[model samples]
Structures are given as C-alpha cells and as structure tokens.
Target chain A: MMGLHKKDLNLLLIVMVLALFAPFILNPFPTDSALAQFNAGYPDLMQRFVIFGIFAVGFNILFGLTGYLSFGHAAFLGIGSYSCVWMFKLLSYNVVPGILLSVVMAGIFSVAIGFISLRRSGIYFSILTLAFAQMSFAIAYSVLSNPAFNLTNGETGLQVYASDPQWLQSASAPNAPHLFGLPMRATETLTVGGWDFQFNVGYYMCAIIMILAFYLSIRIFRSPFGLMLRAVKSNQQRMIYTGLNTKPYTLAAFIISGMYAGLAGGLLSAMDPLAGAERMQWTASGEVVLMTILGGAGTLIGPVLGAGFIKYFENIFSKINDNILHQWFSALPDGLEDFLITIVHPFIGKGWHLTLGLMFMMVVIFLPGGLVEGGQRIGAMFKRKPKDTNGGLSAPATPAE
Target chain B: MGILEVKNVNKRFGGLQALGDVNLDIQENTVHAIIGPNGAGKSTLLNCLIGKLEPDTGSVTFDGQPVLGLKPHQINQLGISRVFQTPEIFSDLSVLENVLIPCFAKRDGSFRMNAIGTVGNETDVMSTAEKMLDDVNMLDKKDVLSGALSRGDKRRLEMAMCLVQEPKLLLLDEPTAGMARADTNNTIELLKEIKASRDITMVIIEHDMHVVFSLAQRITVLAQGRPLVEDTPEKIKGHPKVKEAYLGETAA
Candidate 1:
C-alpha cells in the first residue's frame, strides 16, 4: 500500500501492529501472577526492544544485503548517543535536534570508517571494522572524557546536569528528555483486575520511530538499489563487469546503516538522557549481530524479531534470581528442587548469557537462515508459503551459505 | 580503421612476455574470432581490451577513445561487455534479475542511488529485461534461480545479461568451453540468432574450430603472443601459420 508490493505491505502492517500493541502483547501475565516477572511491558525494557530493533534492522542493510559484516557497528551507535547527549547539554532535552544530530554524526563517521573498511571484503573487512570499533571505544572511554574536555564523562556517562547550559529550555518545559512538552518518562498505567499495563510516552516515541525505520527498510528492500545491493552480495565481479560501480553502492549502504544505528543510539539517550562509552563496546556491536543472525539476517522482519528475542532474554531471563528459581521449584521435594536449581542456575539470572549462547548455536545449526527461515519452513509445511512476489527472494535462501 | 584498435600492446609477467606487441583491428557489425593454443596470449589480449589487465606499453582504444587506464565498469560503460569463460551470471539471483542488472547499469550510469523507487515500478526496464530473456529463450525460466539452471541455460542467461545492455562490442571468452555437443550446438545457434537480430559486434576467443567456423566472419590466429594471421574465416581455415600454431604443439 505504501509503494510496497502486496507481500511487503503485509509484512510492514504486521510489524506496525506488533510495535503499536507491544504493551498488550508483552504483558500477558497479571501483576500478582507467578509469571509476572516474565512480562516485558515495562517502558525501560520495551524501549530497548525497539531501539535495538532499529539498530539490527539497519545492520541487516549492510551485512544482510551486501554481505559486508562490520564488526564495529556499535561505534556509530555510540556516536549517535554522544551526539544526542551533547544536544541535551547545549540546547534542550527536546530530543528532535539530538536525534537529528545523532544520525548526521553517525553518517559522517561511517563514511570515514566504511571508506577505509570497504577496501577489503570478507574476513578482512570484518577485522578492520573490529579494529575501528575498539579504537572508538578507547577514545570515547578515556580520551574524550578527560577533565579538561569532559565529553563522555569517562565511566560516569554523559547526562543532562542542572548546571549545564540548556539555552533552549523554557522554565515551564519538562527538565527531563521530552518531545515538545511531553516528558519521555511520562506513563499511564491501566489497571484491570490484577493486571497493570504500562503506556509510556518514551516507549511510544521509540516505537513510532522504529516503525518508520522499519518502513524505510522495507522500501529499500523493494527498490532497485536494494536489488543492486543483493547483486553486490551475490557477485561483485559480475556487478563491475556489468558496468555498475561497487564502491559507491557499498559506501552508501554503510552510511545508510550507520545513520540507522545512530538513530537508534539517539533514541537510547532520548529515553534515559545518558550516553555511556559502553554503548560503543565491541560486545554491544556483537549483540546487534546476534540479533540479526538469531532472528534472520536478511529477512525484512527478522532483525526486529531477533532484537526483541535477545533483549527479552537479556532482561527477563537475567532477572530470574536464585530466590525466584527456589520459589518456582518450592512445590518439589527439597533435594530434587535443589538439584534442578543447580542444573538451571548456570543458564539463567547472572548466567543468562549461557542460555542465550546455546539458543544462538541452535538457531545457527538448525535454522541456518535464522528464525525467518524457520517461520518460512513452518509456512511451507502447511502450503508453499506463496513465494515473495519481488525482491523478498533473499528470504528462502540459507543465509549462512 | 576499425571500431576497436590494439596497437603494440605489450604485457610482461617477470621473464614471460604474456602479450608482446599485440595488435588487432576489430570492426563494427562483425563477428571476429581470435583462436590460439593455450598460453598464446589470447586471454591476456582480451584482458587488456576489458581493462582487467593493463599492457605495459602501447594503447588499446574503442571507438577512437583511449581505454588503457579505464576501470572494468568504465570499460563496460563505454559499450564493451564481456561474457566470462565460465558463465559468470549472478548465481543467487533469478534469471530475470541477472538481465535486469545490466539494463539498470545501461540506463543509470556506473553509480546511482536509486533507493527510493521500487524495481517493479520500472516498467520500461522490466520490459526490456523480459524481452532480452525471451530472445535468449529463458522467459519461461526467468523466475528460476540462475544458479540452478542447466549449463546451457546459464550460458544463455549470461548472454541475455550482456545483450540486454546492447553493448557496441560483445567479448565472448570460450562461450562453449565445456559444453556437451548438443549444448554447444544450441549455443552456436543462439549466437547466430543474436548476431542476426542486432547491430552488435562480437569478438569470440575459442579453441573449438567448429564454433570459430560457424560464427566468425573474420578471424585472427595468434601464436606466441603475436598475431599470426588476420583473414576471413575461409582463408583462416587453410592458413599455414594457423595449422603450425595448432598441429605443431602436438608434434612437439
């Protein structure tokens, strides 16, 4: 409907619906219920779900379409966050300027990084990106946060302090990060029986932006440029021989994805008004890769699903402490309960990374095309999931290959 | 005077003279065949023409313009298209997409940020690509992944990809290299049809004399990095140097 093919339109609609109604979809359990801890509807976690979804969606444009994996994508995200926080410090907590600057700054940095990194492809490209990300992390963590010129504020992170010159901020305007007059932290709680559903302004803002980002990605996936990106991934030799330049195409995709990552980073600080050097850490970069791969790297909706999946595990699974585990297994015999907790202990709570790692391995090994392929398989089992009418052809193929 | 001129092009690899003082004149609207035994510098000469390799000395020009330092894509943008020896079609793409890429490249320059418009919306380009596929007898298989196609189909798809661009010069490097007899005959017929249907110049490099005789109007036989003979296909059939270039290798 939105200049997309019917199939893409349907996919976009599904994502929009899911994002818009995420609070209800995520909060199935009542507040008093034993499963309430699993509820991911809280604004903090919900905002993260969409923000990282934007990040992975953008990452997929580079890694998924052109098959250029940048191991240091989080540098752009960190740049976005820092730019956003700088806006809050200098201007106001209005968020519009911060987000815009974040995207621009990320684009500029990506042009520099991508220009150099794209010189080599395959594992070399990946290693180059990794090196750049590490350097950026080091610079942001220590160099930029020096006492004489405190930008990132070292490990303390950059936040909107009251003493900071917020020249654009009005006396009546909300002091916290906000859109116009609406505070990002503003929330409405709907109580029904033992269920409490949160409707947070910040989460909605992120959700709306994520939906737009997703729509743009869909348009890109359907476009001629998207086809060329796929062609670049398939056979660069053929592309060059066919009179198509590969450099500008790859560079554009890199910058575009960088801007997307920056937008995501800007959203991160817009919600909390805190910019940490840790956001640029290699692990954060790896997390987006995990999200893209775990969900399905190239698929239109796969990255978002992967982002939500990993964030859910990171937040909800990590919250399951020893007491929560003991309470769940209390009905069992004392010895057996203790044994179960011991076995499960290393895979949950503080060790939730173990569970995530196992799940990632299973996805890679079993569903090599990621979760999207798994969905397509199930859809095919019922009937040949009507093949995508246009550029969505990348879905049915094995992504790992 | 011809459309493409190669003048004293010399390319050396350490002690080996890959292509030494190679000279050729390829005319427009003709199928010119370049036949040589292995390591006779036929591929090297072709590489020089396509910008894959730069000759150490001398100039290669297409349509009176110097093409010596141009990039591969730049060479292509100047209306020179090459079909590789091993059918280098986009394996992951559909047959239609394989042709569509060159069409986009032909219409748009070397680099275009056409990120906003849908490919499906490009009705003119789509029709052109489909027409090329139809000419190659691959319209029915346009949706089929180019990788999964039979050898003959891949060859034809590659042909479609090149022909869709409608380049002034089409370079074919061993177009029927490893094909079975039936597939070879089909490719020959396809080439004949393509030649008859358009105002295109084709320069084919081949070891197969049957293909060389069937399609080439003019022939150039090379031996030891130099052109031994340039004649019509009939005269080339009985040329003594051409015989020595082929039969001498076996006798030695």
Candidate 2:
C-alpha cells in the first residue's frame, strides 16, 4: 500500500518478464539465417538498453515531474564514469566501490549544480545547467588532463592501468572488472533448434540494477516529494504562495535524477571499464531527453520503454548496409531495386540518425505524450473509457490522464 | 493585540510612492476589506504584508512575529495564505493534488525528501484533502485536471487549497476580479460560508463596492498611497473623504 499501486505492480511484473526473457525475445532470428545480423541478443547491446534506461528514468524524474529541462545531465554521467574508473585504477577491479562512489560523487556534484541552476527556472535553468556541463566538459578536456591533475586523462580516455596500484586485487584474480570471481564478461549461450539465446552476466547485472532504479523511480513518482515536484511544474506561482519553498524540493529531485545518471555511467564503466570526456557532451544529455519524451514523460514505464526503443533503433538501423539493402530488394526488377535502394539509402547505416530524427518528429507532432500515451490511447479506445463531462462543464483537456 | 500589525510600512517603485506610512491592525477572525480606486496602493500594501515586496522602512508582524525579512513560504508557515486575483491552482495537477500540495507543506514544512512515502496511503493527508474538497463542493471532480476546471470551479479549488491550510490570516486579492455577476455572487456565498464555519481572519484587497459592503465588518480606504480613512463599513459609505477620493462626483 505504501509503495506500488496495483497498476504499478502489474507494470513492474511486465518489465521483469520482458527483461528476464529479452535474450529469447530478441534472438528470434535463427542462427546462420540471413536475418541473424539483426539479432540483438548480444551482451553489449542488451547492457546498453538497461544502462540508458536508468539514465532516461533519472532524467524523467526531473524533466517530467518538475518540468525542469536540464540540458546537461550527461555531465553527471561522465563524472560517474570517471569516478568509477578511478576506483578501478586506484583500488581493484571490483565494481562495488566504483558503483557506490559513482552515485555519491554524482550526488555531490549535482547538489552544487542544482543549488546554482535552480535559482532560475524555464529556459534560463536549462541554460545554466548547460553552461555548467560545458564547463565540466572543458575541465575534463584540458584542465583536469594537465600534468598537475590528469584526472580525466584528456582525449585519450581513462581506463584500468595494469601498472597502477590495485591494492585489494589478488594476483590470482582476473584482471577485468568483476563481482568477486564472477567476471561481467562471462556469457552462457543456449542453442535450441535453430535459434541461439546468449545470456551474459553483464546484461543480468545491469538488468537487476535497472529494475531497482525503476522501482525507486516509481516510488518517487507516487511519493509526496514527487507531488511537490509536479506542483512546481504545474505552477511555481501557486507553489510559492501555498507556503512551499519550491527550491529545495526541486533541488532534491535534480540531485536524485543526477544520481540516476551517475548510476547509468557507473554501470557503463562496470560493463566496459572505460570513461571519456565525450560521454559528458550535450548530445548525450539530449539523447536522454529524446528517450524520455519519445517514450513518454511522467509515466513510470515510459522512460525505460523509450530507452530500449531508441537503443534498438540505433543498433539495428545502423547495422543495415547497402549490401544488405540490395539483398532485401534483390528479387525485384532492376529499375525498382535500384530506385528502392536509392530512396532507402539515406535512412540506413550512417543515415540511421536521419530515420531516428524523422521518427522523433512524428512522435512529437502526432503523439505529444509519446509512446506510453499512444498505448493508453489505444487501450482507452478498446476499453470505451467514459467521457468526463463532469457536471456538464466544458473543460479543455489533454493527456492529463 | 492585533493578529497582524503593519507599522510605518512605506514602499516606493522608482520615483512613484506605491505606499506611504501604511499602518493597520488586522483583528483576529474578522473579514476586513481594503477598498480603493485604481492606482491607490491597495495592491502594493497587500504585497508588502505578504512579503512579496519589502517596505523601504517599516515592519510587518503576524501574531507579533516580524515577517518583513521572512521568505514567502516562511511567512506562510507563520499561518498566512494568499489567493491571487486570478486562480493560481496547480494547473497541471489533478484537482485533488492541487489541494494535497499545501497539506504536505503544512505537515512537513517547506522542504522534505520523503520520496519513498506514498501520497494516497497517507490516510491522514488523503482524508484532510478530501474533506477540504468536500467543503468546496469539488469532492466529486477531484481527479479532473485543475487546468480543465471552469472559472468558478477553479476559484472554488483555490479557496479549498488556501482554507485547507487553515491559516490564521487569509489574503484575497480581487477574488472576484474577472467573474460574471452571477459567478461573483456564488463566490460571495462561498466566502460567507467559509467565514461562518471557521474562526479565520481575512484581509481582502478589493475594488467591488458591492462585495466590500456585503462582507466587510470594517473597511480601510487607501487613496494616493495613503490611508484615506478606516472605519465601520456603514460609516465609510457616508464619509466625505471616501466620497471625494473614491466615489468622486457621487458624494451624496
């Protein structure tokens, strides 16, 4: 009663089922089949889904409920990665300390940023956060990379160094990052009939973390703190007048969201033990925004769904080459085959971003509430939802439901 | 002793004196109205009292606590709530949530991180908000978005949000500013009902003579950033200064 509503419990069950069976669901293409190239059961891509899901879920907490569009959340992500990597370099290959430190470090950083940026609202808040993030990027690029510090390692990227002291690590232990003796790189491949499902340890770890993150987000969404954030979004004018010091509530949400991004970043390093200044760029921050909006903001499941959808498009769409296109249209007549390839060329491989942009545009225009709203709209139509003309008052409406 | 004491309050905006030496003792549990013609510093004085604008040199004390340097929320925590000229309900939240915001603030103060605690199951908060909504006759439509509410309903929702806090002083700035006469009457009835049921003091800045005369026990007339007169509503209606400064040519 204090945590999940019945509906939210159902959502959690659905997500758990999906995540538990994704290896099978995503590997539908049989081994050695022509479509095998499209198989997303690989560990790398699955890990990305859960990781970015964490990122988007965190972003949604700030942007969705509070309507504070932070254009620099990726700075926290980059900082998380850097902190995690530093943990790996100085301590050992264990991910526990790295992940813990990442969240804590991101929390500290966000508190400072939130205290400063939350003084302004609307586009000004966005600009302030963006400027702080850009400054962080610059510091990571040059200042921190200098011989006096060299914290970020500049453009070369920071990674585990064999020469560095790993005091807690046993010489007998595997050099890669791991939980105790279980390496994140371990994979268990199952072959049934012609299909092959590969379940990787890293994916499961990320999946478990993502589920916890989602659960925390759902709790926050339904919490009193969350209601305050939504009130802040709805009308700061009313909020201030209602005796609510809105700044602290917003700052708390911002820091929590930043910690979410940090968790995502920590997981990134945990899975692949690397950190780069480019990870903190504004484009990365924009990606999380796109993921949240494209999936549907303010909904419990939207951010994760959005994260998976975008990652799926990025991975699958970017893998299709001209040769694959020719193969797809080979049976057609020469003129038609050539024409189709020409038309489809710009939207595949290097042009996958173009397809993504168009899809996002369509989503924004036709489905303002994003994919979750679309699902609800369909559900509402089928369920014959009652039209709310309460007391026969003609009221303006939107996806407020 | 007065619940609210405004002493030597002066506010200036650039070269224009918005309020000059404004002093008033707002008694407990009384519906007091401050009426004036346009540009008569009524709104400015209200702003100073609510901590929106600080007086150049003066003090505002609510329940004898200095409120001059306090933030808006801090002042609110001292039991002061204001309803704007236009309805200022949380437009994006559901009707129930608009009322719940203040309940949370009332219980938890201005800032809290009880992020994991559920709102609906807080039985205490839910029942309080529901009771307030019921009082405002909006219990049935609590799930509707506040933005979608009719003008009269929005006003009702705002009143519910304010009164739910059960502040010691309620500040209403032109509560019926944009309403039709029918809606204005409805608001008047609602305000009367609210006042009769609770021992709450109210400070209202108004332009409507009808509303002022109908509800106010005592009226203060402000003219050109100065208090023209303060007296019983009946006495103020016949006062020559009020007639000259406000009623103008209609000095009967």
Task: Please tell me which predicted candidate would have the highest lDDT against the true structure.
Answer: 1
Task: Report how far off residue B63 is in candidate 2 (Å).
Answer: 0.9
Give the range where candidate 2 chain B is weakest over 10 consecutive residues by summed lDDT: B243-252
lDDT of 1 by residue, A1-401 (tens): 77987778888889999999999999999999999999999999999999999999999999999999999999999999999999999999899999999999999999999999999999999999999999999999999888799878989998888899999999998989999999999999999888899999999999999999999998888788999999999999999999999999999999999999999999999998999999999999999999999999888899999999999999988999989989999999999999999999998888999999999999999998899889978877999656665454333222222
In TM-score terms, candidate 2 sits at 0.97
Q: Model 2 misses residue B50 by how many Å? A: 0.8
Q: Can you give the DockQ of every candidate in the order shown?
A: 0.62, 0.65
Q: List the residue pairs that clash in candidate 2.
A: none
Total clashing pairs for each candidate: 0, 0
Instruction: Considering only chain B, report the TM-score of each candidate against the true chain B.
Output: 0.97, 0.97
Predicted complex 1: CAPRI docking category: medium
| After superposition, candidate 2 runs with Cα above 4 Å error | A387-401, B247-252
lDDT of 1 by residue, B164-246 (tens): 89899999999999988899999999999999988999999999999999999999998889888999998988877788888
TM-score between candidate 1 and the true structure: 0.97
- Model 1 stretches astray by more than 4 angstroms: A384-401, B249-252
CAPRI grade, predicted model 2 = medium
